[model samples]
Target chain A: MSLDASQFEAFSASELAFLAEDELITILPRQNLSRMDFKGWVQPALRALRRSEVPLWLAVILKRQDRCTIIYPNWLDATYLKTVLEAEGRDSASFAALPYMWQELSDTILAEAAEDCQGSVAEIMRTLQELKELRLNKLRQGVLVNNDSHLRMDGIGSAELNLVKPILSKTMRTLQTVKDAQEVETV
Target chain B: MNLDLESIINSVGRRGTRTRAEYTTAPAQRLKQWWVAERMAPHLLEYQLDLLNEVITNCRSLRDYIEETSLTLLDEAAVESLGEETLRDVKIKLLLVETELERAKFVARAYKRTRMAKIDLLPYYYLQQQESQSGIMSKDEWVYCHHRTELEASSYYKGFLNAFPTELQGLTDEDGHISMIETPDMDKPVVVRVNTDIGTLKIGSEEVELVKNGVYLLRFSAVSDYLEFVDIL
Candidate 1:
């Protein structure tokens, strides 16, 4: 059966999961957290997915269409996206999900400090404080997530965690966008 | 490569611009005129064969890629980056191949038109003309004659009427009369009027009532004859 535009409005997570399993396509948002003003980005981004007339294979598997709105609408837009990526020293090709953005931020600002200022209580305090603040700000703005969102990060080792900790603690919400795309394809 | 501005300017001035009308006959028709029908047919056949081959090759490659890759090895993320690129490439190739197919169809149409123009269409016309010059006389002894006083004398009454050539067999006399013969016995002349191509003809004694109108053939008879001509009375 052909999908009607109206059918997109009330799809549930279970229905989406079933679709993912059967058709190997998923178009639902991976995370629906309502922190800060994130809903403003989420609604429009999800709306774009409803408007797309992509094939079933594309619609189900590359669930990127829906998750992109929540985590990366600004990046999707041509000019602002370029500015944001450029600020973090990332180009179009290297810009993956939000974690990549955080890595860029950490490498540029915090990575060297974590190593050089070890054992200094004052420096340690400052580093922890800084990372906490970043996380809190993202949480408030609904731009990213911290450990509060209840998402498990499996398959990542300790070294990878250390590398991702700064960004993931605050900006991991964007990973939902990637998960959403994967779920669509799996179905 | 060398500095020669003055010479270049003189050369430009020597040549003048010419203008002509825009519309020209299509390339396919021009091809038919240049190459005979037999040669054009083979070229058209070859073009269709080549188009089919290209489409088949493209489909095979796409099918191979789909069959060989697994969802895990080439997961959604990997496909996301490359799928759009592949679709775009295929779209361009399809459009180029379809243009050749359209050109071949145009050439085939031109060949058909050229072949039809080489047939003959004029046997029945001459038969009708012969009937008019010598009107048909009935088996009975009757003659058809027309009396003309000096005041009514006209060029039509003054000369021997000409016979129509074989190509115009359907020709008729001015009065819708065809040919005439001597009455079975010596009797008043009877005029035989026939409806044929254009004007009718009067024959034998021109005394019969002149029919200004043409006669219509019966549908079944006309179909059987198939060579009759129609004209305004």
Candidate 2:
């Protein structure tokens, strides 16, 4: 079914079903997939398909999931920063903190949430760390900063380090609390 | 329900792609799958024509309800308010409620739009099934799981990033290969390779040059998509 953009328009529920058959993502079944928080996957998918230069605000309604899962893969790619810099006619490397801002937000939220949760705390903490690690690695990888001069700003000039500090403190406290609770339970 | 509405109901598709053959040809398969669609087609048509009639009646009732309630509230507040400031506060509260009502109406409009979207998708599904070698499914039988999957892998990922904004961090290069950035003394350097089904975290000083720290998150995505992650040296 080679359909033009016009043809793809005005889909009925049944047409949506046909589209589902062809276009659905094949992930691990719900039982296995249940172990992870898949709600975080939405942004990367949207970014990959970002053709419109003007950013569009997404309002997602998941069929299976109750909450609207908004994924921001901004932490995964630095193109957004480069785009902003290019848009401003600046050197671009100066604003490498764009993606890091996103990472810090994720880490902050997760760290806060992990404060009380017991069962999924470890997993969530791991995920947040992974996000942080990705951002740091991306910074050090130095993909955009052409020369070593641009790299000089590196970790020192992040728009997100302030946000990251509080998140780290919260995460540490939560981990300590959880460890204490575990020890008390053992006793 | 009346003859005039019935006549109009039968006439809607005539202006579109309904040919003489389509009108004359009996849809036997449609009878089996969408017995309700065929049987209720006439009733549905009648309903469509009378929709305006029902809507008009509803609007009249809503108007009457609003007028009655607004007048009652206004009179009650007017009698109770002793000071000008109190009256002003009452009016502000009333204005807030009115604003809430308008907001609710906007939500209702959006809900109707989504309902219309579902309704519009129906004909496309019908046309697709009609042309298929396999038999058509009933409206109730239709599922969008597969499409949802594709959407999740692509669109959902992007939407998630927008809302949470941290799913993707720190990528300055896009050279088709994954790149890892090394940070001194950062211990939890987990190397997770997708397609190989492997995960290794650095425990000691043994340095593993990474394509990037992003390999772990990508591994998560791959794993979420049910792909194996293989750790490569």
Candidate 3:
């Protein structure tokens, strides 16, 4: 049947990776293989250059094994990330849209091929962390000021939800108490 | 207890005509069939176990929802003039759902019981096989086996520990005193900066002066109770 956002959010990384969009990656094949076989994804024909568009999880595995090199995304550029960070500082809610599997893919790439990449992995990681913090701060502010009982946020993964759930719950409790006190005073 | 090689081969044969004919052709063929089945059983069983757990969880939720809806309908029928035929139809649907729920619950429990029995006997089987095969166990295999046992035991202990609250699950130190159970409160001490002119605040037995715009660290549990007054940092 039908599934809700929360249910889909609880899916494991592997399951989510299956549904993730394919990214164009340049992989240097270690062997002269005719094809690449990753479970749950289509087997792509290996070219002479060994570069192919593949899912994020498969790309990470291939990169980890040193079977291929994944070309970094343009947004992962140090200059672009720095600009984004500045923008976030000015308006946290106005940050640019991220890829559906941006968090998982970036984490995998940094973990597997941090040293091998052209740009420093630490810088990329720092930018990602800063963006996450900015979004979380925006969420906290909204919770405190907004009177609505239900808070709807899209594009938040299970990992991010877990990080903010405790604080959000606490904020809701405080809001409820304030509402109760006001009602009693009026009565 | 005896390794019924013939019976194992016969069972595997029943699944395919080719295998059935092959089993009776030669002793080597019979042995091969038995070997294949033995190798595949555990892997197949593992997949089946996972599928069973998923089915069980889904069925439990469905059953609970149906039960709740049935109660609500019954209450409405009592207050309003719902038709007798419609009420009877609802009751029949509820009965069928209850039956299916019971069947699902029974199947889940039976599978779990059988799996637990097999797990409980595995160590004994390994010990006996080790004794008979004497010194054949590789160092890596020995370590792997012991690690699995340790993991199983620790998981059971963890389930036991969950019965106690975080503040009571501390281990006793060398001085025979229970150590403070570290929780989120201890890990992330709640610090607040007082904006308004507040008087002295007593937390537990200690009293601290609250000055305007003064920052102070307070116990998370204590402050959480009155979180409306303070701004959490």
How does each model score on lDDT? 0.28, 0.30, 0.47
Please give the interface root mean square deviation for model 2, in Å. Answer: 26.6
* Prediction 2 global C-alpha lDDT: 0.30
Q: Interface RMSD value for candidate 1, one decimal?
A: 39.9
B1-233 per-residue lDDT for model 2 (tens digits): 46445434543433212322331221221111122121211111111213323333433444454565468556866556547644543343344334323433432333233333332434333334335633333232234422433454466556564565453532222345653322111111112333442344332222222232233211112222222233210
In the range B1-233, model 1's lDDT, one tens digit per residue, is 23245323422332111000100122332232222312211111112223333334444443444344434234667656657745433333233223323433444443333222211111122223225643221111011112111212334333322343534332222333553221111111111112344342222212222233322211111112222232110
Per-candidate alpha-carbon RMSD to the true structure: 38.7, 28.4, 27.2
> How do the candidates rank by lDDT, highest first?
3, 2, 1
Per-residue lDDT of model 1, residues A85-133, tens digit only = 3432432112223331232323322332232222443443444344444
> Tens digits of per-residue lDDT for model 2 on A1-187?
2222232122233332221221111111111111111111111121111111111111111212221222223332244433443432343333333432343333433333333232354554555455345455544453332211101232222233332323332343344456557768999
TM-scores vs. true structure, each candidate: 0.15, 0.21, 0.35
Q: In model 1, what lDDT does residue A152 have? A: 26
| CAPRI-style grade of the A/B interface in model 3 | incorrect
| B144: Cα error in model 2, Å | 19
Best-first order by DockQ = 3, 2, 1
Instruction: Between candidates 1 and 3, name the one with more favorable lDDT.
Output: 3
Q: Which residue segments of model 2 deviate by more than 4 Å?
A: A1-187, B1-69, B73-77, B80-82, B121-233
DockQ of each: 0.01, 0.01, 0.02
